[model samples]
Target: MTATAAAPEEDGTAPAGGGTASGQDASRPVRQIVPPEDLHATELAFLAAHDSGPRPPGWRLTPRSVVTFVMGSHGAALTLPDDARAAAGTPRRLVIDGKFVGDRALVERCVVTLAGERALLLVGEPGTAKSMLSELLAAAVCGTSGLVVQGTAGTTEDQLKYGWNYAQLLAGGPSPAALVPSPVLTAMSRGAIGRVEEVTRCLPEVQDALVSLLSERRIAVPELAGGPDGLAHATPGFNLIATANLRDRGVSEMSAALKRRFNFETVGAIGDLDAETALVRRQARAALERSGAAFQVDDAVLEALVTAFRDLREGRSAEGWEVERPSTVMSTAEAVAVAGALGLAAAYFPGDRDVLELLPGHLLGVVRKDDPADAARLRGYWDGPVRRRAEEGAATWRALWDLRTVLEG
Candidate 1:
């Protein structure tokens, strides 16, 4: 049966005691990462009003609009129809910015999978924004992205299915008041999308807990059997989206049965250099802005940073030169982080060192993460690409080539 959507707080988070805050800090930190629901609340509301088409059970926006929300409007302004504008009370026109930098078809497929209420699994190397995509999808499909179970080796079936409040359970026996529902269970009852991050990291048995939930679409509560709350049936809109790091392939393999339940989508690194560089600059600027500082890193430096990361990540250079790949994944996410660090350094330590001078050291840090031997591989990269570019009269490469001593120490 279809269930009405729960009213979310202004921040798009579930109300207190709703079990969405499990494993989260009670107090809000100053520099906290905002959830997609809160970050794009206006976009979500606007899209909801913009698209008056039919939505699947419990969805906030139509399937087409959900895809548009994730992939953006392609620099065009979206306007709400007159009836929607008057009723929804949102802006008449809004230009939605693209959040995830990937193929639009991939996002369309994801939206279709969610519309079908099937389990969606996003698998990729670390930092491909798999989790971000999952959050965006959940926030758009439902009203909130707060229902989450962070899967880890220590994860238990209780975390995936249900748990109990010791005090309540002690005072009263096996009642709804005494039984604490997990985020998944809460999502089932509320008919909202629930997210499981790093699902493969959970123990095999722990991960298998979801097999039955996905197949049966309900959790049998033997404790409350024969009562009104005996079986926790999933509301019409309930579904799950999970993410796994390809790097963590063998930590805890998912059961074959569990794999069959999910539609696996592999999220790969960005293909175009200019797009990757733009994303890095944009994210780095946002990071610096959060600290009340301007991003002063040069465009050339940002492009170089991304280029080096791509080279190390792909084991080949832009000029078709073969370079040694590092054991650690030189992900685009890491490039953004390094770019942000460079911006922070430039802003706080003005004139102390050229941001270009800091690039080699940051590259060294990223390379040395997995193997100390990777340090030499980075040096080989410098001697190969950096040296070649320097010989070609590129000033940026010359400056980077001059910093070869940084990698030596």
Candidate 2:
């Protein structure tokens, strides 16, 4: 009935013991389950055995379950039983963390592309959760997303292929011990997901390392003394997922060959207001709890904050009044931070002044991060849309326009 309500089980009954509140006569008390540190290959194997679809080699779940894991499952809750949850020594629920927040279709495309043995490339603006999505996808399929190469201006070919252990190479003369595998090579050996973040940030030559790896499915280490095993061939379910920031356009472009080798998916910003508000609320509460701070902000306040963000971000009011969007990204992350700030303000200031009133100021501060042009953009939003809405007599818009001085100053 409510958003926070516990969804019913398959048998059309409430979850075991009716609710989290258990009576003395009940078998066990309910406990909340948190995710574990590492999701191992064996653990993946077990889940795959029970998983309901055709699984690819080395993958724990079918592509469907893998999607459910990253996007969350609503059909059947995979929570631990109450008794199991309460048992001290018993293992907790196998919680799959969903790091990405956008489309189910995008996630499915990424998974499908990987399964097809194609390198997957995620392209998106800054702060669009491109890196986070890659990490979750890798973790879900391979049981670990730890094998990562952070691509930057200084990224080298050795970082993509392999580097020799200097001491071992000198003494033992390029044996297996001397052959140091890069994350990509390690994933190839283990049949796991290898990640390259900000791939476009790397120089053209460095980016070319991926071209050979994807097409040939092996890395040639000439320094290792040529041998059959010296060329690392991907076993199975081994694929690379790389993210490139669209905002960083001209930094370092990938070669045509490298680009052609990968299937690309573009991630977009949050478009749903309610979803964005809930995301902000969830993250704000989590932040407060993590810091041992109490949360008391009202839902209406959060809605208003999200609404303002959406309006400024899209350069239009909900009813279609025109505004100018700032250059800064109005990501869900920024909304979460603004909500957290309001919560802290409420805790400290303790006033009747509505939290929504603090939005324009906080938003101005967020938008005016590094450039004066962004401040001008905020002014344009106020002068155009805010003015129009105020003239049309929307009380909330009028009040927000009154606070335009906050941005101007």
Candidate 3:
């Protein structure tokens, strides 16, 4: 029988009529939030003695189960025993969220690189979802996403290494208490994936701090008097994943040495118009639903919006028509945002003609973020590719093109 009662006060005292009268079943299991995968590194090694598979040392489940945990599986349902299950609560459904939207082969390549000994660097334009994917990968591998170093202009060697606590440093003179481990150091000790986001944003000197760490698989702290002699040795399954934005080109370029340490993968922007449209539609619907608003967007309006973005992104249209691309990145995330704006407009205006009426203006707002020269690029796209497509008797696109003045005005 299930028991429902108000929780007791924090002073360790019960309310009136305490003692089991509250119908409290003290033996009930508390809910937990574990990853969908059944095993962890230590547990996997213990199971390896009885089970049969290619078990990598320090990994919880076999590599195959790890894959299923991340991508979801259709075979036998993997489960944890009641004891383990109750201790950790129910496992999170292995729902692989967006990281990279483009190539499966690239993801496979990254997975393989991590499975081996190499570090992986995900390079892409801003808002292309590189860091998100890295987070997902790290969470999948180690069952934790807490190890991270966010790269920036002000990031220092100490931020990536150990920093001395001033009070402890003065008291004990570089003792272990004075040493505070950076995220990278902690990940090395735990054998988990350490993430560094916006890697190129860090100044060259600061970025170089990773070179020694990756090559040696250890962090050396000369000042700390009594911590592992000199080096902080990495545990067995430790790895690193870093993300750099390509749009931030020419700003603090990565050293050749650091580049060689990682297997680089460049994530591309959404190229297919249909794919972009579908993604926008799905994302917008979900957002509206979350907001407790009814999603009533027209499919044709979404297609037009995506087509405009694709043309501005690629500097061309589907039918061999030339268009001037925008200086801004026409990312999938931005497409979803624009679609969401239109949805909001629909919810408010109710009769704002159609969502297509808001497309060109939203496109203009995004493309005109930086240089005024971007305005010319956007106008060129409409005149060339959009004009050609409209002239070719594409009805829906023609209607959107008719709103070209929205860009100029």
Clashes within 3 Å, all models in order: 0, 0, 3
List residue ranges in candidate 3 displaced over 4 A: 1-55, 60-62, 65-100, 167-173, 226-230, 288-294
lDDT of 2 by residue, 176-243 (tens): 87788899999999999999999989998898878888998887766554566656678988999999
Candidate 3's TM-score reads 0.77
Of the candidates numbered 1 and 3, which has the greater lDDT value? 1
C-alpha lDDT of candidate 3 relative to the true structure: 0.69
- The Cα local distance difference test for each model comes to 0.86, 0.74, 0.69
- Evaluate model 2: give its lDDT: 0.74
RMSD of 2: 6.8
| RMSD score of candidate 3 (Å) | 9.5
The lowest-lDDT stretch of 10 consecutive residues in candidate 1 is: 15-24
- Clash number for model 3? 3
RMSD of each: 7.2, 6.8, 9.5
For model 1, the stretches where C-alpha displacement exceeds 4 angstroms are 1-31, 85-89
lDDT of 1 by residue, 89-180 (tens): 34566667688899888998898898885899999999999998999999999988899999888999999989888898888778999888
Rank the candidate models, highest lDDT first: 1, 2, 3
Model 1: how far is 238 from its true place, Å? 0.7
Q: Model 3, range 1-409, lDDT digits (tens) per residue?
A: 2334533446433232222221233364422222222213222222222224564555544555444434433332333443333223223121122323466666667777777778999998876768766865676667666688998898999989878789988887877667889898888888888889888999999988889889989887777536564668888888889999998857889989999999999878776677667768877875765455667778887887777777667776777677767777877788888888889888877985777778788888898887667988888887787777789898876987798889887
